[model samples]
Target chain A: MFEGVPLTWFLIVATIMFFIGIYGFLVRKNLITILMSLELILNSVNINFVAFNKLLYPQHMEGMFFTVFVIAVAAAEASVAIAIIINIYRRLINIDVERIDEMKY
Target chain B: MLIMRHELLLVIITVILLLVEIFLPDNRKHTIILPSILLFFIVTVLGFIPGPTGELFGGMYATTPLILTMKNILNLGVLIIFIQSVNWLKKIENKGKIGEYYLILLSTLIGMDYMISSGDFLMFYLGLELATIPLATLAAWERFKEKSAEAGVKLIFTSALSSGILLYGISMIYGTTGSVYFREVMGAFNATPLQVLAFIFFFAGMAFKIAIVPFHLWIADVYEGSPINITSYLSVISKGAAVFILMIILYTVFYKIALLWRDVLYVTSILTMTIGNLFAIRQRNIKRFLAFSSIAQAGFILLGLIGQSQLGMTTVIYFVLVYIFSNLGAFGVAGIISNVTGKESIDDYDGLYRTNPLLSLTMMLALFSLAGIPPVAGFFGKFFLFTAAAQKGLYLLVIIGVLNTIISLYYYLLVVKAMFLNTSDQPIAYFRSDAYSRIGLLMCVAGIVIIGFASPVYEFILSLSHGLY
Candidate 1:
């Protein structure tokens, strides 16, 4: 079941995007950037779901439905994350992950 | 309707709480507490009623005797938390937001209920998000507190990240199998390289929720920063729900790769148990102490899972039931003390027995239960888990589990020693916990004392788990 754009290409791009997300998550100092990285990770997964559905299994709509649910859930998660970020900014006057360690062992 | 009775009733109660809050005046915000607990208590009791059990919504939602029992266990734990939190919620600092707290908590419970009953990964994803996102708000409930806000940020960030990984794994599973339904996926699953990678991602995401070793860093801070009641909810109810779902999925959907996952569990279990025990040893803050101990408990739960049969499922569920009682008892005493005295350190607990003998006795029983000492429910829980693992002939893992149990006993005894043996000039002053909290603690104590000697409870779980594998 070959197509104009191969499934391997899509998988490669998603993998790259996913790893970039992992990198940003580990390296980012600011909370909003980390949040963005999370979105990147999720969006990459959405790409994988969509491509896998269209390319590998066109007869099934489950992956498409899953992608839609994921997008909706990711939005909700982003709103909650931003609320938390704004709250952290209000309380600590910054959203730097390094400076937020008040309860370390 | 019959299948989702638990979630439906919980949602209705949340709406009732919300409407009641709007009608009630400001000074009487505390009144919502009683109604919330009463309504939730009714829901908990009603959950045990025999009901229709089968597939729903094109097999997206399902329930069985085992799933009903799991939901009932979660309901019972949340009800106790509602009762235990009454005093904290009544504080002036919490003021008008009391209704929102119950609503958010109820939503999370609903999420968990759906997650537990999910027949398809789509429903599971929705329930997982519903269960998780509100909890971030709860972690940062005290938005003005720096640590609380930090905890919220960390929790949301990590949970979002983990869910993303989990979804990616689900995408792969869907790609390979062309279905997200558990039954369909299980039939098509294989030990292919990509499927193995997908399983690992799925396991890691779940490990984050369960607070296994690699993903447990966020737990201590979150537990300490959140309100004491939220902390207990996270550790007991939230963790229990995740464990139940993970066990179900592993035993069913991933049964094709049991050997692969068992090896993974064997390594992670040892790391989780040893690391959790070691970190728990030096914690000064009681919340952090319990945080690490609960992580260790999660590790022990893995031993039961590694057994990989009907007996494994039985022990894991049984242990979780016992754990909820034991851990909640410990946190109830700690919460009451913290709420009344604002002293949260081990040092502050010195000479506690002199002033408050009953609280001290409760703490001692809780600690003993945690240490898996004979006569309490935790010992029986651990004993059964060990027996299940040994039945599978995982003798070396059992030995390490036993060793970790010893290490855990020492730390638990340290708290016991502080409360009963250590002396200090300025001990916490005696104060009576509210009647509601006393009732909650009493329930926990009763559960801990009674569950061990009750063979019928084990038999019931075993019977329910008979066809799980």
Candidate 2:
């Protein structure tokens, strides 16, 4: 149980993970690494949703439903992302964001 | 069940299309195109039939006349895109995958319908994800094209990042209000610091989708790389859907924080308009030019939002409708040219009037409409949006809007000049556009001309906007 763990603690962890994900997203070059960063961002939000549901409003399952949907959607998104990464790799022989500037303004 | 008639019809059609896709031979794939368009046409027509409107699934999904109207507008845009894409779909490179395009396209439409109808955060997120993920695949549609693949990657990356940010905001709202339902959240929402932070995140995420200035970096590249058909869809249909939902949420759920969001809109609108116009002036690729122009259009739509009244809502919706016609008209011409001649740069369009006078005319009309010139629906749309803002005593924003309109007219005229005034040693040769493209262009022209002169459409939208807030 999450008893005796203050909500602020969970909130603190999620916030850190979210920023770390954003940092990775900005700093990383490879497509898959950026995707992993996206996952980190999503998972951190998942943590926030779960902690809020279980701690703040124990009666309603709204946040729980939201978490389930997020997990499902994130999985779907990851699959799509991988498919796109593979497609990009095939066409260009690399997935580095730096190298993928074929259509820049 | 009746409340979501539009979504239900689209789902049925999608299922039928899937069944057809399963049974059809790979070589015979293009056979599905006509039937798919015909079926979707029926669904688009069915969407307009008056239907019962109310909540279902425990207040998660709801509908209203205004929502119905928005869905209808989207359906109209998709129908035009479908018609216009027939020529592109018939290409040798796109031969075998025609059915897949229709199926994916329909599913995304279904997603947008649900997104527009969503009454809760959960439904909204689901609809939003369903709407977006497949679009990345479509962006990468020409898998053999290097730029298309890159577009897919960029689109998916930015969308995933934006959605993550948006979900984080929703989680915060959930934490603060203890509910995700819009009605409940609306009652509980206040201008607390955490709630305001949540709103900023939500706005940023939606802004990325709408391609608002600060978050608009992904747009030009994605638009330039994707096929012209997909670019137009992204600019008009996808962005329009995001704006509709954002407006709905801000007006209904975040009305309590009006003062906060108005300030945000004011700053973003100015930056979005100025930056979009400045960048638009430099773009040579027609798609990227329109991309920046659409960003400026989004800024203008924000002026309507800042008004924060029924008139604002009406102008936003009306302007979006007018925008669908004008933007698509411009893109349709560009698309047919690109498909036929493989030329997409503004310089390539020189002396277009000498060879393809009709397309040049269509492009001119569309560009003029986009610049808010008189005798077009766009002028009326802009006039009303300015009126809405001026009603709110935001004269400064309105003036800035008018100035931007003039600047936009200048750049738009540059394109017009290339077509009409500038002579090229080698003009694009005349070739008649196919039947479908003509029909598509005709529809857009008809909408542009009729929607402006016909006062009933505006009055109808005004009536629908009255009780929405």
Candidate 3:
């Protein structure tokens, strides 16, 4: 079944995942949920990279190298973000983004 | 081997600073200063050493003299930020995280250096994401402040959106052209409609980082909510580095589509200037006002990009250097004033000249420079920008740019008028800056004045742009 999948299928799946991430990012009220959306978007990017690596440039693993770096950085980013979110929770007692509008005009 | 040694030295210094901060007591963590300064010196020296602009890691990493100069400028900016933040950091109740702040800032700076020097798209995206994600956290460093949290949310959302668009554009380009290296893309581009569409998407994403109009809504709120130091970093260094990279990428990858982008940029220039100025006119919050004005200045930089000539690159880089000092001077003054009065409104600046003549004069010079008035670096910056635009026969864009400069002067002068002209109900208390911030501000003021008179600096920038392409 996987062998029958065309390159266009990979693009379509990636696009779907990207849009879902966007939707979650826009609709979610909690900071953590929004961060998860960001992660999903990143994962979609990784999928694109791997797919292109497999199909377009099999001789070189440039896309795979980028994917590894992206994963590593995303891990670092998520840890820092979670720490900040926890700090915000301690201060405000909630993670709802709408309630954090104290700075907006 | 020598270049690798230099890179290794930088890595060691950065890691050692990080480790030293982890072990130090909260109060004594100020000792991180010695290493920070040492790292700055090392990076500066490394930046000047002549080396071949060779590709590393199978053509992914590339460095040139121009990229080295850009890195040096960013290092200098980060050093100033470190010095400027000393007092501001001391004032924070939660001082334990101070070392972490420096570490993150250094990492972001490293990422930016890589971003500008990157010849391949893979490294470019990696560097961009690394530089940006930390800034979103920095926006909310004041966890107790609700606005800070809001700013963080807005920044992350916008960044995620733009990243998605940028990624899609990158994928499309790869699909159509079968390459991710910039030079390869340029070699393969046929000016197809799909390629143009991809370029537009990529440009739009970059425009967000530069905070040009229509992509600028988050800027004012983010600047207001973030710690003043971080806001200064975002407004000047972050945006400036992005523009530097964008200029290089466009010059290399999309020279074939210059005519199309020039027309698009011409209209963007007018709209950005008009909108940014009109919005700036109505802002009461000083940070927000400067934020919009910075957006307008981004539009002016876009005018330089439209020229797409060697002179245009020189003008853009020169203007960016002047802008670094001018905007940082303004923000530094704002930071000092906010520390003292806890007020951030234009009206609250009433009778500031009476309270503190030195700060008032410094601020006046900064504002004058920002408005492109005579005898200040800002004037020369705008003059070069207009000259570059006019060289491209973008007479209409130049006319609008000049007119917008005049409109911008009105609002900038309003702050001056408040400080010198308006009467106060209560005497504004004069506050003293620590030795470091004072020196930083003095250096910025000195740079503004001296760089204006220094013709060789302009010539150097022109030669550097020629070297870049």
Clashes of each: 0, 0, 1
Task: Please tell me which model should have the higher DockQ, number 1 or number 3.
Answer: 1
- Sorted by TM-score (best first), the order is 2, 1, 3
Candidate 2 achieves a global lDDT of 0.94
DockQ of all candidate complexes: 0.87, 0.90, 0.45
lDDT of 3 by residue, B139-174 (tens): 988877777876776776687667767876786787
lDDT values for all models = 0.91, 0.94, 0.82
Which regions in candidate 3 have their CA more than 4 angstroms from the true location?
B1-10, B49-52, B92-94
* Stretches > 4 Å off in candidate 2: none
Best-fitting candidate, measured by TM-score?
A: 2
TM-score of chain B of 3: 0.96
Docking class of 1: high
Window of ten residues with lowest summed lDDT in model 2 chain A: A96-105
Better of 1 and 2 by DockQ: 2
Model 2: colliding residue pairs: none
